[model samples]
Target: METFNSSKDFLRGINKKVFIAVLSVAILMTTFSAMAIRKDVVLVCDGNEINITTFGGTVESLLNKQGIEIGEEDKVIPELHERVTDGDRIVIHRAFEIQLVDGNEETTIVTSRKTVEEALNSLYIELGQMDKVQPDLQSTLEPGDTIRITRILKETITENQEIPYQTTIKYNDDLDYGKTTRIQEGRSGVKEILLEVTYEDGLEVSREVIEEKIIQEATNEIVEKGTSRYLVTTRGDSRRYKDVIVMEASAYTAGYESTGKTPGDPYYGITRSGTKVRPGVVAVDPRVIPLGTKLYIESMDRTPSYGIASAEDTGGAIRGNKIDLFFESREDALRFGRRKVKVYILD
Candidate 1:
C-alpha cells in the first residue's frame, strides 16, 4: 500500500512540471507575436514614393526607424505624434534652399512651394507692374537656385535748358579785308524740358525726353565781314589801291654781275620798256604787274622804304611777286641785298 501511494505522487509531480513548462512557452510565444505586429505604409517624400512594412507605432517612430531626418522648414502631411495604421500613406515635403536677391538685399529662403510665384506669395512679397523677376514667376523652384527681383520705377521731371542762338554774317564792301564788325550781340534763350526718368532700385537707369516748351526766344547775332583793301602810308595819307602784294626785293646795277651785260652793249643800261634804268625803275613779272605800272613800295621790316617805283624793266630772274630795283653803283646795289616789301598798285 505505501509503494503504490508513492508511485501515484511521482506521476502527479511529472504532470504538474510538464503543464508549467507548456504554459511558460505559450506566454513567451504570445509576447513575441504581439511584438512582431507590423503595418504596411506608403511614404511619399519630395515626390518620391516608398513602400515599407514597419513595426513602429507612430509617424515619428516610423521615421526614426527609417533613419529619416526632419528640418524646421520641412513639411509633413500628418503630425509626428499621430498614430500610424496599416495601409496608411505618409507624405513629407522637403524644403529646398533658394538664394533670393531683392533689390539691395540678399538673403536665403527655404520653401516647400513648387513655383516661384507661390513662394513669393507665401512670404507676402508684392510685385509691382513694372517690376521684373528673373527666372519668371511660374518657373519651378529648384535647390540652390537664385531668384532676382528688379524694382523698376519711373518719374517725370522738369528742367530748364539753354537754347543756342543763330548767327548771320553779311559782306561789307566798305570795310577792309580780314576785318569784321559785330552788328548785334547774341543772347541765349530758355526752354523747359520734361523728362521721364527710369530708376532701378533707386539708381538711375535711363531717361527720355517727353516734352519741351520754349520760355524765351533766342536772339540772332549779326556780323559784317570786310571785303575792301586799303592801307595808310608813312606820310599819314590813306590810299585806296586795286591790290597789294608782298614781294621779294633785290637791288642791281647796270653791270655784268647784275645783267650779264657791259656798257658796250646796246641794251646795257636800257630797260625792256625802251627807257633808261634809273633809281625808280624796277623789273617785275609782266603776268603779275603790267609794264609802266606805278607802285609804292614800303619796307615790311626795319629797313627804309623803296619809295615810288615804276615797273619798266624785265629780267629772267625776276618772276612772280619779285622785284629788282635799279641802283647807281655796284657797291650800293650790293649793300641793299634782298628784303621783303609790300607793293601797292596805284590807279
Candidate 2:
C-alpha cells in the first residue's frame, strides 16, 4: 500500500509540473500577440500620401518605428505624444528659412508654405494694385530665399507755367544802322501742365508731364532800321549825305575885276544871294546846285581839299557843272587855278 501511494504521488507531481509549463507558455504567447497587434494609419508628408500599419502607442513612437526622422524646423499636424488610433491621419511639412522685405521693414521667417503668395497670405499681408513684388508672388520658396515688396503711389497734379517769348530781329532799310525802333512789345505766354508724380514708400521716385494746354499766345517784338547812305570824310569821319556832284571849280577874290565892284560899293563883296564872300562860300549854277545848299568839297587832284562849303551865290562865269570858290586875297585867288572837285550835298 505504501509503494502504491508513493508512485501515485510522483506521477501527480509530474502532471502538475507539465500542466504549469503549458500554462506559462500559453500566457507568454497571449502577451506577445497582444503586444504585436498593429493599427492601420494614414501618413501624409510633403504632399505625398502613404498608408502604414504600426505597432506603436503614440504618434512619435509610430513615426520612429517607420524610421521617419523629424527635425526642429519641420512641422507636424498632430501632437507627437498623442496616442494613435486605427485609421488615423498624420501630416508633416518641411520648413525652410526665407527673408521677406515688406515696404521699409524686413523680417526673417521659417515656414512650410509652398509659394510666396501663400506665405504672405498666411501672414495676413495685403498687397495693393500698384504695389510690386520681387521674385514673383507665385514662385516656389526654397531655403535661404528672399522676397521684396515695393509700395507704389501715384498722383496727378495740375500746374500753371509761363512760356518765355522768343525774340526775332528784322532788318529795316528806312531806319539808321545803330538805331532801333520798337514796333511791338514782348509778352509771356501761359500754359497749364498736368503732371503725374510717383512715390515709392512715401518718397518721390518719378514725375511725368501728362498733358499741356496753352492759355495765352505770345507776341513778338519788332523794330525798324535805317539804310541811309553815308560818306567817309578825308579824316576817317563818316557823315550822311543826300547827293554828290562833280564840278569845275575856280577861285576868285572880292575885287573890282572879279566881283564887278570896288570896296567902296555896298555890295562889292556880296553874292547874287546877298551873302558875303568867304573862303567856304561858292557860286554855282542855280539849276545844278541850288543856292543856300550845304556842300562838302573834296579835291579830286593833289591840291588841298576844300573841306566844307555852301552854295550861296551865282556868278556870270559860273554855269552848269561850274563853281566859283571865293578868297579874301587876290594873290591867294590867283594861285588857286581851275580844277575839278567833288561836292557832296549835306543832309
Candidate 3:
C-alpha cells in the first residue's frame, strides 16, 4: 500500500483503469457489429407473413438470399425491392387469377395488364357490327379483374312456294270458245320464296321473308269436266236453234188415280212395289191440286230440262205439289239451288 504515495496518487491510478475498461468495451462492440448476422426480417405474401433470416440491407438483397425474384408489375408490400431494416415489414406478391367469359367462350387469363382494352386487344379479339361490350372498353383493370368480348354475324337464305290458274265451261254454247260442255271445273298452283335474317349477341336479331314466284301452277277443274271436244255445226244455213222442253208425258197409272196421272220418269216411272210412287215424288192436297196432279215447272236452270227427271218418287223432303227435281250430279243439284217458281197444273 505504501508503494504509491498519497490519496491523490491512488485516485489517479483508479481513473486510468476505469478509462481503459471503457475503451476496451467500445472496441469489442465495433468488431461484433461488423461480424454478426443481421436480425430476422418479416416478409408478407398476401395478408400472411413469414420470418426470413438475412444479412442484407435492401429488400432486393434479402430477396436474392431468399431466392425470390420480382418483376416490374409484381405486387409488393413496400413496393419493388425497397431498402430494409431489421424489423422492417416486406411483402411479395404474385399475379392473381383473372377470367373472361363471353357468351359461350371462356378464357382463363394470366396477365398483368392494367387496362381493359389492353387485356382484350392482347388476345387479338375483333368486334363485329352488332357486337356489344360490357365494360365500356375503357375501364381500368384491377389485380383479379376480367374483360369480355362478344361477336356477331349476319346472312340470308332462299326457299320455295306455289300459285294457281283459271279455266271455264258452259252449257249456253257461249263458253270460252273452242270446246263447249254442260260442266265446269279446274286445278291450282305452288311457289318458291326467299328469306333474310340478321344475328346479334349470338342470337337471331331480325328476319325478312320475301315471297317470289309460283313454281307449279294449278289448272281449273270442271265438275262434269268438258269431255266433248269436236261438235259438227249445222252446215251453211247458219241456224241457231235452242232445244225446247215438253211438259206432256205418257205413262200407265192405276184406275184409282182419278185426278189424272202426273208426269213420270223419262225412262222408268212405275215402281216394282205396285205403289204408284218413287222416292222424292210429291202429291198435292186435293183442295189445292190433288194427288196424281201434273204440274209444269220452269226456270230451274239455263235449260228447262236437260237431264232425266221423274215423278215416280215421293219423300219427306217433298212438300205440297212442289216436287223436288233430281239430277245425276250432286253439284248439279246444289247449283240448281232452292228457288220459288211458277207451277201450272196440267193433267
Candidate 4:
C-alpha cells in the first residue's frame, strides 16, 4: 500500500509540470494573436507624414487613439468610418476658406479639395458654353484663392437706315450764260442693316455688322448748265461761237483811189497789225469786232465764201458788223459790189 501511494505522488508531480508548460504555451499564443492584430500604417496630414504600428480597427478609432482631431469640413481619404488594414494609408486635408465670384455675385466657401474643378463640383456650380473661369478648372488650389466666373451673352438686331441721294449735272444751250437750272429734285432712300452685339456680365463687349439689304432705290438730282452756242461753217464743219452777225461787205484795192495816202507812202495799204492786205486779211471797226479777232465770212447771195479771216485793220465805213476786204487790182474791186453777208465769230 505505501509503494502505491509513492507511484501516485510521482504521477501528480509530472502532471503539474505538464500543466505549467501548457499554460505557458497558451499565454505565448495569446500574445502572438494580439501582435497579429497590429498593422504598420502611414498617416499623412498637415503636409507631413507619420508612420506607426497600430491595432487594426476603423479609421476613426485609430485617429482618435493618435489624439488627432477632425472638423466637420476636414477631408479624410478612405473615410473615417472605413476599416483599416496592414499597410493602409490615411490622408487628411484641412478645410480652408475660398472666395468664389460668379458673374456679379460673390460668396465665401469652405473646402478641402485639391483642385479648382473638384471644389466647384463640391459646391454644385455648373458652367455654360460661353462662361469663362479664372485660374482654370484643372489648376491646383491654395487657401484664400479667388475664383472668378463670367457669363457671356450674344444678341442680334436689325435696324432701318437712310441712304442719301446723289446729284448729277448736264449741259444745255437753251438758257443764257452763267445760268443753272434744276431738272429733278433729290430724295432719300431706305435700307435695312443687321448687327450682332455681345455682352459680358450685363456690359457690352463688342458689336459687329452682319448683313445689309436695300429697301428703296434712290433718285438722283439733275442740274442743267447752259452757256454756249455753236455755229456751222461753210466747209460743213461745226464750230463753237459766242455770237453771230449780218454785215455789209465791200472790196477795195491798195491804190491811190482807195486810200488818201499815195502808194509810195510807207503806211499806205498796210494794216494796223503790220500785216500785208490779202484775201484773208480784213478791215473792221475796232468797236464791233476786236482787233486780232478771227472770223468766218460767207456771201449771203451765194456768190463766194471766205473760209477764215482776221480783223487787222480799220475803215471809216466799217462800223458795227460791217467789214472791208482788200483786192489786189482795181478791176477786181469794181467787180465785187457791196452786199449783205453772214459773219461768224469763231472760238
Candidate 5:
C-alpha cells in the first residue's frame, strides 16, 4: 500500500509541471499577436508619396518611429496628438532655408510655403503695383533660393526753361555798304516743363518728359545791312566809285628788263587787254580787278598822283592788293620803286 501511494504522488507532480509549461507558452503567443497589429498608412513628404505600415498609435509616435525630425516652420496635415487609423493619409511639408533681399536688407528665412507669393503673405510683407520681384510671385519655392524685391517709386516735377531769341538781317539799298542799323531788340521767352521721375530704392533710375508749356513768346531781333556802293576820296573830291583798295604800287616799262621780251617780239609792248602798253596802263590781279576796268590812282605819300589809269594788263608778281604802273622810260620806272597808294574803281 505504501509503494502504490508514492507512485501516485510522483505522477501528480509531473502532470502539474506540464500544465504550467503549456500555460506560459499560451501567454507568450497572445502577447506576440497583440504586438503584431499593424495599420496601412500613406505618408506624403515634401511632395513625394510613401507607403508605410506602422503599429496603431498617435501621429507623433509614428513620426518618432520613422526617425523624422520636425521643424518650427514645417507643416503637418494632421495634429501631432491625433490617433492614427488604418488607411490614413499623412501629409508633411519640410521647411527649407531661403535668401531674401528686400530693397537694401538681406536676410534668411525658413518657410514651408509652396510659392513666393504665399511665403511673403505669411510674413506680412506687402508689395506695391510698381514694385518688382525676382523669381516671380508664382514661382515655386526651392531650397536655398534667393528672392529679390525692388521697391519702385514715381514722382512728377515741374521746371522752368528759357528760350533763346533769333536775330534776322535785312538789306537796305539806301544806306552805305559798310553801315548797319538795328531795327528791333531781342527778348528771351519762358517755358514750363513737367518731368516724371522714377526712383528705385531711394535712388533715381530714370526721368521722362511728360508735358511742356510755353509761358511767353520770344521776340526776334531785326537788323538792316547797307547795300549802296559810293565813297569820297581823301583829297576832298567827291568821286563815285564802286570800290576802293589800298594797294602796294610799283612801276614797270615795256623793255626787255621788265617784259622779258624785246620791242620787236610777237607779244612785246602789248597788254593783256589787247591794248598797247602806255603811261595810263596798269597791271593788276585779274581776280581782284577785271581787265578793261577804268581806275584812278592816287599816291598816299606827298607825291604827284598817277592820274587816270586802265586795268588793261596782268603780271605774275601782281597778287592780292598789288598794282604795277606802266612807264615809258626805264629811268622813270626805277624812280617809282614801291609805294602804298589808293586805287578807286569807277562804275
Candidate 6:
C-alpha cells in the first residue's frame, strides 16, 4: 500500500511540472505577437510600404527602430517624425545637384525640378528686355542640360569723316615714279561712315561692318600765268643813276615787256641792284633804303604785313606807295584792286 502511494505522488508532481512549462511557452508567444503587430499606425513616406514590425507609435521612431537614417539631401513624401497610420503611402527621393556656368564664371544651383527650363524659370534668370538666351525658346529641359545666354544689345552709330583731296592728274610724261603732272588743283573731300555696334549692360562689346560708301567728290583747281611787262626811269639824275638808291619798287609797262617772259632775259622786275622783283614787288629805293635794307610792308589790302625788302626795279604800274601783286592766274591778278597801303621800314 505505501509503495503504490509513493509512485502515485511522484507521477502527479511530474504532470504538474509539464503543464506549467506548456503554459509559460503559451504566455511568451502571446506577448511576442502583441509586440510584432501594431494596428493603430501608418507609414507616411512614399516609395515605402508599412509591413515593417515597429511597435513605435511615430514615423521617425519607426525608421530609427528599423535602423534607417534619413539624409539631408534626401526627401520623404511623408515628413519624418510624422504620426503614421495604416494604408499610408510613403515616397523617398534622392537629391540631385547641378552646376551652372555663364561664360567663364561658374555658379551652383540646387533644384527639385527635373528639367533645365523649369529651373531657369524658377530662378527668374531673364529680368529685363535686354537679357537674352541662345537655346531654342521652347526646348525641353533635362538633367545636366546646358543653356547659353547672349546678352548683346545692338546700337547704331553715325559719324562724319574727312576724306583727303587727291590732286587731279594727267600723265603728261609716262614714268614709273609716283609723280604725275597736275592738270587741275585739289580742294577738299568729305565722306559719311555708319557703324553698327553691339554692347552689354552699357559697355561697348563689339563693332561690326555694315554700310560703307563715298558721299561727295573733291574739287580741282588750276594755276594761271600772266603775259604783261614794264620799265622805269629813276628820280635821281641820269648821269648819277648808279649813285641813287631806290626807296621802293614800281613797275613800268615798257621795261617789263622787253625783259620779262623772254627766255634769255633776266627775271621780270629785276632791280638795278640785281634783286629779282615781281608784279607785287615793292622794294625800297637803294638811295633811300640802301641795298639789303629790311622793310615790312602791308602788301595785301588791310591784311597782315611783311618784313625786310631791298631796292628793286621800277615798274609802269608801281608808283610811290603803290605795288602790284603777282598771281598764278590772270583772273586772280584781276581780283586785286588799287588801294592806299603803308610800307614800314624795319631796322
TM-score, ranked from best to worst: 1, 5, 4, 2, 3, 6
Q: Score candidate 4 by TM-score against the native.
A: 0.59
lDDT of 5 by residue, 6-88 (tens): 99999999999999999999999988876667788999876679998987889989988988878889977787889888889
Question: lDDT: which is higher, 2 or 3?
Answer: 2
Please provide TM-scores, in order, for all candidate models, with all chains considered together: 0.63, 0.48, 0.34, 0.59, 0.60, 0.33
Clashes of each: 0, 4, 28, 0, 0, 46
In model 3, which runs have C-alpha deviations exceeding 4 angstroms?
Answer: 1-21, 24-41, 45-48, 53-56, 71-74, 85-89, 95-147, 151-314, 317-347
RMSD of each: 8.3, 14.7, 13.7, 13.3, 8.1, 16.7
lDDT of 5: 0.90
Pairs of residues at least 3 apart in sequence or in different chains that clash in candidate 5: none
Instruction: List model 2 lDDT by residue over 77-132, tens digit each.
Output: 77688988878899887888899998899999888777889888878899999999
Question: Which residue runs of candidate 2 sit more than 4 Å off their true CA positions?
Answer: 1-52, 55-74, 77-91, 203-205, 223-234, 237-347
Better of 2 and 5 by lDDT: 5
For model 5 the local lDDT of residue 182 reads 90
Distance from true location, Cα of 287 in model 6, Å:
71
lDDT of 1 by residue, 16-36 (tens): 999999999999999898667
Residue 228 error, candidate 5, Å: 9.1
Q: What is each predicted model's overall lDDT from 0 to 1?
A: 0.90, 0.85, 0.54, 0.86, 0.90, 0.52
Regions of candidate 1 where Cα sits further than 4 Å from its true position: 1-50, 54-69, 75-99, 108-119, 135-146, 158-160, 176-181, 190-194, 210-216, 225-247, 254-256, 260-277, 286-301, 307-313, 339-347
Per-residue lDDT of model 4, residues 248-295, tens digit only:
998877788876777789988788788887778788988889989888
Q: Which portions of model 5 show Cα errors greater than 4 Å?
A: 1-39, 44-50, 55-58, 77-91, 170-182, 223-252, 256-289, 292-310, 315-347
